[model samples]
Target: MNIAVIGLGLIGGSLIRALAARGHRVLGFDADPAVRATARDAAARMPATGRWQVTATIRDVAADADLVVLAVPLPALHNVLDALVASGFHGLITDVTSVKGQVRDAVATRLTGAANPVAGFVGGHPMAGREASGFASGDAALFTGCAWVLCLDEGVGLDDWLTVAELITELGARVVPATTEEHDRAVAAISHVPHLMASALAANAAEDLLALTLAAGSFRDGTRVAATRPELVAAMCGGNAEAVKLALAHVIQRLDGAMQALEERDPVKAVRAWAAEGHATRGAWPPDPGRPEEVPAHVETLLRLGRAGGWVTTVAPDRRTVTGFLPVSNA
Candidate 1:
């Protein structure tokens, strides 16, 4: 596959490494020269060989690519697509934007033409990231075993979906299909709201400078993602406002309950219950469940299988499920 990846940050850089490993001809484009240099070197280290090139111009990168991935931030997705459409580029396009509902709308509205249609666009988000940014922190295995979402819009053919899924799967991710609205709502609960909460918690704690100075591993670990690119997080939160607002309502209720318990001098019990709930939830959840859990369709499958097999799975602290695969029988 001749692949063009824009952005060249952690997500884009990691994609380059993954594709290169499968011997795909990958061309990378980024605004930052240093990132391009690093990606070029990273491509060399892969087991497979491909024509790895870097260019400042999007047209040059998209010129020969059969598949184009706009791995830039959510806000940039539309702009990139617009430019590609203007450049008369011909290829199937997808993006790794966190918020899909808005992105899908943007593409549908902005990139309208006989040349550019919604059918050529597949909205995507990889539910895997690092607290760090930039190409330097990109690891070859960053997306390995992670959930890569494929949001199919109307007119996107079965063959296009399969092509996109194959590209992502070859990069070591499991593919799951999602509607734009469904993806936003679910991720708002699991990913977006958590980042907002982490930042809020860490910020509030910082007011107590002396106390925060003694912050332990727990605090640091809890707030690790609070250090992610603020602009990107903002885009995610803002893009999916309705879903995030609903998710935050649940968050607020939980926080108020916890606070009320603390005010009643039962802080220890409150804390214990919170921690235990996480433990119990994770324990009840299935173990080693695959990426389809990211989608609601497979969620019921998991629940049905769980109820039938005494498995309980959760998405809260990270995906986990506990269940028994039906025993093999000799025929």
Candidate 2:
């Protein structure tokens, strides 16, 4: 497939390398001239994986490309789409953004015109990243074993969704189909809130010499993603503010209860009672993702699999079936 990718940052650059390595022609573009030069120079030393080049302009990236990946930050999505719209790119488009709800709305509004009523836009968010940014940290192996989300909203075209899913599964990541709303809510409870927790933990311990010295695996691991760039974290948390707010309410309530428990007469018993569910949840830290199975690659089945904590490992090339992992409810 001929593919064009915008924003040659870590995930974007990695997408380029991974797809090209799999023999897909790729053309990538970055706003930063230095990053563009770096990618071009780096692509030189790597063995010929597939045919790819760094385009001089965003407009050029869409020319004759089968798929165009918008890997830019959340706030920049509109501008990128506008550029693509102006350039008359009617090919299949997907994104690697953290937030999906906003992207879905934007695609529906901007890309759906009378001339192109059936816009092949499938909102995507690859649940993979690094604390580091730029094209320098990109690795084709970054997405291996990761969960790549492909929005499965009602209006999403089946063929378009399958095409994006196929590309994601080909890159060695499991495709988790979900609605834009479900995807946003799930990610807020999991990814966004966790990042906030990590930030708070790090902030509370900063400049305290003893706390820093005594920090072990628990503290270090808990605060790992706190090392991510601030602007990037802000965009992620801010872009999905409504969902994040809803998720934060539950977290705040639990924390308030825990604090109240600490002040009780029988503090130990109270605290443990307050934390029983949390303990069980933490103990199940990477829950068994269930066994893999092949199923018809229909939207209803994919959504059912996702709601059951399952993911699609492989989609049949003809879009008729998929090999997916259907997770257990209590394993």
Candidate 3:
């Protein structure tokens, strides 16, 4: 397979290595010359069997490619898509943007007006990354055993979705199908909010040198994500603003409860119970039972419902049905 990856940063560079390792011809592109040089150096170090090259421009990368993976940040995605459309390179397109809705909208708007729209564009977010950035930090193993969320909408063809899924699986990641809205909301709660909390903790502690010196494993673990690239963090949390706002509101409400509980007659019991709930919730996360051959039919149905302004919950392990609660607006 001929794969082209734009942006050549951590995710893009990693994809180049991973796809090349799988015997796919990978051409990488980055706006920054330094990044391109770094990727070229990295490619040179890889085994001779892996076909990898760094391209000078997006058009060069897109030319005759079977798949084009956009590993650029959210802010740059639409512009890149516009460039691709202008260049008249039509092929399957996928992205590693953390937020999906915006990207999907951009693709739809751009391609709808293009002289020749690309073969397809699928919004994807790999549930994998690090506090690091740039091509120098690229690692083929970064996505191994991670959940790669694929956002499907009316515009996506089933075959294109499957092709992207197969590529993700080849890179050792599970392909979890989701709607753009669902993907944004879920990540806001699980990923974006956590990063915000981590940044908050780190900023608060930084004011006190004594507190910083006293910080241990818990603080270190809690604030690790605070070190992530500011531009990347801004693109993610900002791109999914509404969802992140809602998630942050819920987080604030929970914190308010904890704060109020501390003033109760029996503070220890109140705080302990609150803490226990989180502990239990974390402990109950289902273990990844290796990737399924096909995402369950019910899961796809849930994604469809999610697109129509509803919440879907998977029923207990009967593994056959999903329940959706529609929003009042939809109802």
Candidate 4:
């Protein structure tokens, strides 16, 4: 696959290396000269089985690219899309942005008065990252075994979605199909809210020197993502603010239940009751996906699989079917 990845931050740089390592011709561009220079210097020293280079311009990156992966932050997505449109290059476009709805809307905005608004745009969010940022933190294996979402929203071409999914599966990530709304809401509950909780917990603990000094496995494990760059966390969480707000409120309600229980007459029993719900939930750290089945290559079926917490491990080359696994849905 001939590919171009814009933004040489942690995700973009990692994507570039991953694709290039897999023998795909990848062209990378970063708005910052320092980042481009860093990648260029690394390209000189690091030997890979495949080919990739740092381009000076977005237009140049798009020129030979069959698929363009925008790895920019949410705020810069529209501008980068504008540049892609201005470059007069029209092909498959996907993104690694954490939020999905905004990307879907941004592409839709540009596609007004078109024959097919959602034909080329396949909203994507790889459920993978590290606390660190920049090219120095690039990891070719970052996405290994992660859930990479490819939004199967209405009007998205199955072929386009499959192309993106195939690439993701090649990177050793499970491709999960989902609607834009579903992806946003689910991620808000899982990814966005956790970041907020981690940050808040770390910040509150910082006020007490004794707490910081006494912090151990529990605090370190819980607050790990608090080590992430605030700007990056803000961009992701803010991009899906409405969904995050709802998820955050839900979490608050749960905490309130536990807090109120602490004041009950039988505090021990009340607390135990509150903790049981969480204990049961977390005890199922991961549900068993029994086996892979061939699902018909259709949007509705794919989305259903995703909504049920399933993922496609492989896609047939002919696009007739996808090999996927789905957890048993109680609902």
Clashes of 1: 9
Name the runs in model 4 displaced over 4 angstroms.
46-49, 111-119, 328-331
TM-score of each: 0.79, 0.93, 0.86, 0.93
lDDT of 2 by residue, 202-240 (tens): 999988999999999999999999988788779888989
Cα lDDT tens digits, model 3, 193-252, are 999999999999878999999999999999999988778789889989999999999999
Q: For model 4, what is the C-alpha lDDT against the true structure?
A: 0.88
Residue 52 lDDT, candidate 3, scale 0-100? 93
With candidate 3 superimposed using the best TM-score fit, by how many Å does residue 234's alpha carbon deviate from the native? 1.8
Q: Give candidate 1 misplaced runs (Cα > 4 Å).
A: 41-51, 262-277, 290-331
> Considering summed lDDT, which 10 consecutive residues are worst modelled in model 3?
287-296
Q: Could you give candidate 4's per-residue lDDT for residues 1-331 as a string of tens digits?
A: 7899999999998999999999898899999999999999888776766547998999999898889998999889888888887787777889999999888888888854464332388889998877677889989999998899998887788899999998999899999999898999999998899999999999989789999999999899889998877887898888899999999999999999989999999999999999997787777757777689999998888888887889998889899999999875232
Worst 10 residues of 1 by lDDT: 322-331
| Candidate 2 TM-score versus the reference | 0.93
